[model samples]
Target: MIHPQIPLILTALLFSAFFSGMEMAFMAASKLQLELQEKQNSLTGRIITHFSTRKARLTATLLIGNVFALVLFGIGMARSLYPILTAYLPASWQYPAVFIIIQTLVTAILALTVAEFIPRSLFMIRANTMLNVLAVPLLISYYILYPVVFLVVGAIRLVVVKLLKMEFSEEKPVFGLTDVDQFMKKSLYQHETEKVPEVDARIFHNALEFRTVKVRECMVPRTEIEAIEISEPINALRQAFVQTGHSKILVYQETIDNVVGYCHQLAMFQKPTDISSILTPIIAVPETMLASELFVKFVAEHRSIALVVDEFGGTSGLVTTEDLLEEIIGEINDEFDEESLLEQELQPGIYLFSARQEIDYLNDKYNLALPVGDYETLGGLILEMHGDIPNEGTIIQAPPFTITVLSMDENRINTVQLVRQAELTAED
Candidate 1:
């Protein structure tokens, strides 16, 4: 006849296998996996994420469960052997040696077969899918057993800290911005991980940097700011709006320095007599304001764009919500934006660019060490280096690269060619 303890032993071993697999699955899944799963709006993903975030609690739950299973297994094994020991063994021989030997042999066999090897191997093979399947049951079990698990974890911590006068702190690891950037880029570049795409990774990396970027860094400079004089004819204002491709135009009274407010192009439909009739009061922000802070301000104030002002209260430039977002997510080109504005790669490590391309974009995209102070664009950089308007086809040598002026106006660089020295040497 099968021993009464046999069912109990099987139950314990079954639970042991489950707990082992659960532990392995949870451990093997990365944070990136959790994030991607959550993005997909999966309930299992959310549950796993909840547990992952509370690692200490999850760990305690797993340890408590496994320990309890082992204890049950031990009790079952002892009970099953008790009758045999009493009937077959001599009293003295049955003392501890036979029980110990039998229990150790059984434990070792079960540990390898049921508790350690099979479950772990299966869990590791499909960690994410396993976690998704197990999350619901695991979460249910977690709630039911949480009180006991909490007490056990608390007692253990109390003993380690107070009784032993030791510190046992769990330092959760955090991925730095650089680490995240590299991870996302590599994941996309290799296309090995389907969760993070190239566009998403690039945008995420830029978004991380957006928090630290200042308004001045991405603002359209005063020279580039399209404005209309309040005294100008409505047709003149229409031309300015059409030419600049801006829905909102800065309105100044006497001079561009005296920016009074802004007028939306749609307001032209109202056929107001003057600029003031359609003017909306603009938010003026210091150039030093963080893009993140500016974003919050823009949201709270219901403003899409703000006039970036210097310490003297003169308009230095303008920053829009789009500009701030583009700082994090890359440029958002609309129908209004010229398609040719985007920098083009002519060859490996060689590019064709407008002089108007921001130095920040160049540095971020190319990892260049171009100076930012008193200059904002490649054209500005070339001008500062040459101390004059560079003639068309004139070559200026910057270490590791050379800039050739392709076209220029009297004041600003229109287009240029950039060639890396390494590529030039390779071609030669």
Candidate 2:
């Protein structure tokens, strides 16, 4: 009752899978090409955006070869399997099984392994290099594949999308924002690309910081900032820089908030006898500047920092590229920075300690004062308590953090961390 076109029909179906899978693998190279040539346009840029461009020669080979392969299988199925299967397999059974099993299996295997898997693996292997080489061909793939796939899917989409009001793109591939975020933040992403821990940390931190960070979150308190008075003597100004070791010193009119200008370290020694020498213009930015905008200014100026000021023209605090970077890296320390943090994790959140760091910095970070006094340093507070260093295990109210001493080094308190009992880390 039926012509035996079984083999041909089966082959056609198998071929479709190969083409689809090829499209996916081709998609990978396309992505890489686009990323590389995002700035470099022309045929090169077009190619970079092209689906066939990433792994060009191979993709073109696949595109040409696989298309014919798809036709062979499709013809085989329509002419051969359609008749025989319609006759042999009961109509009820054919509809249930979809009457396309053999072809499905073949194409699925070829597409998964040969077209999709193999090509994607290769593209990733040479991702960076191919980005330059394959830009053009990928674009060709885009144009070639889109219409063909859309034609195949258009009638089906018309029924589902218009009559049924279902929404889906048969020709266009889709992904989510989370996918992009994961790729950017993934450890494997920049493994060989950027190996430095600090650099990696900075990248990760920046990704996280961009979401909702406000200026107030990073601004230094009005009190701790060391400023230069406009009329302050040169010796005092020089002394201030030496003691605080800050690069951009805020030069204020009268009060710390009433800032007028900034002194760059590079120009510090070059300050002439002229009164204007000490009065360099400040790199002032608003508290509302988006982090991304600030990042751009940083790149254009080739500088790593800026000053956050109020609308009234007063200095609020400083923001270094490093500080912004720290939003990702946790913290960046140089050879000069001492690791005065607690030596051990005494408990889940608590840390043991010696008291020697500035009380103001600690108060700023840990809020260790019950009523925060004028006292500026931790060592100063400990000394003032009994006019001497308290012995091991001295209990006192340091305001926010509970003090539990483990050891002391003569007059210097040493070996301590905090209990971080409350939401300390979040508040700071």
Candidate 3:
């Protein structure tokens, strides 16, 4: 018959292995694996997901159980080893320290190899199967020890959190806006490099970035806005409408700053041609308004276009529903819309781009290390470098890449060309 101490030691070893395996399995289980199992109506998946949702509590339960098992194992090892140590050592040297040291070394080796390492190794490779087999026992232990674990956890948290005033949250780490932007860009890169259908990839990529886009980034600048003065005659308004080929036009009283309203071409013909009679109340939104939010607001307000205003209540620009939608679906061209290339490689290394083109796009397409921070557009980047608006023919040297202002519109760079100085010199 086996000695009582031997049985106790063996039980302790099994207990240690069980808890270690459970902890490893729970932590290593992938979300995708859990999801697939849950879809297949697996009980283990449901249980694991439940524990995962309350990770802190599950962790506490595992720690408590593991500690209890190890304590029993330590006690049994000390008891069994005491006699063997006494037989080897002399009377003077046969002290508790000797037995304790030997027991500690042996116990640590046994705990690490037999209890922790082997179990953890097995659990990692066969996590789903191991977790499935051990689910009921783990769940039972979790519930049985929960009250004690909860009290211990609460007492520790009270001292660590309340008195220490440290932040402790149970929620899982979440992805921020920046993370989402990067993830979308990565996905887009994967699609492009992997040769996903161009149309599908473009649609997918545009849809992802649409939410983060701001109205000011895509709005038609005030300089380019076609507005009819309130005093303009009906015949003049009709002529202006025909020439502009715009269905609706902003109706301003004295200046664009005093934009009264907008009038539809259909309304203009139905009523008097005078801008005031056909004028409809227009909604004003800040330039900082997100494109997605603007889209929702447009639907709720039943309006097609809004005048983007500055902090000082002056008209900054105009944004249409089409402008917001185009952020996701690409440019919405119309009969009146001018067909122009936003970016073009003039030659081998030299390229010309519209000022409105985003700096990120230029960096990605040209494989240049353009620094990105507060500035979004190439014009903004140039302006930031100059500390003022750059004029026509302003050759701004940004090291590896040299930017030349090809065209300008008053306060901003309209068109700019970038060329690698080294590459251009080599060619010359």
- On TM-score, the leading prediction is 3
Regarding TM-score, does 1 or 3 come out ahead?
Answer: 3
Per-residue lDDT, model 2, residue 309, is 76
- By lDDT, the best candidate is 1
Give TM per candidate: 0.63, 0.49, 0.69
Name model 3 segments beyond 4 Å from true.
1-45, 55-57, 87-90, 105-215, 235-247, 265-269, 288-304, 321-340, 387-391, 408-412, 425-428
Q: Rank candidates by lDDT, best first.
A: 1, 3, 2
Per-residue alpha-carbon lDDT of model 2 for 1-428, expressed as tens digits?
54466565445445444444445444443343244344455455444344332333334445654676666655554555455667887666877357667556654564456544665566566654554554344445546665564454566667878999977442232223443454455544565775422334346545665756655445454544677787877777777778877766778776777677777666667764532475766577887676667767889988765778767766666666765555555557632234555444555556544454555455555444423343434544655654666777776555555665567766456655556546456655
How big is the positional error of residue 51 in model 3, measured in Å on the Cα after superposition? 2.2
Separate clash counts for every candidate: 0, 36, 0
Q: Model 1 off-target regions past 4 Å?
A: 1-28, 35-50, 53-57, 66-147, 153-187, 190-208, 233-235, 242-245, 328-330, 334-336, 342-351, 358-376, 380-394
Worst 10 residues of 2 by lDDT: 170-179
User: For model 3, where is the 10-residue window of minimal lDDT?
Assistant: 191-200
lDDT of 1: 0.80
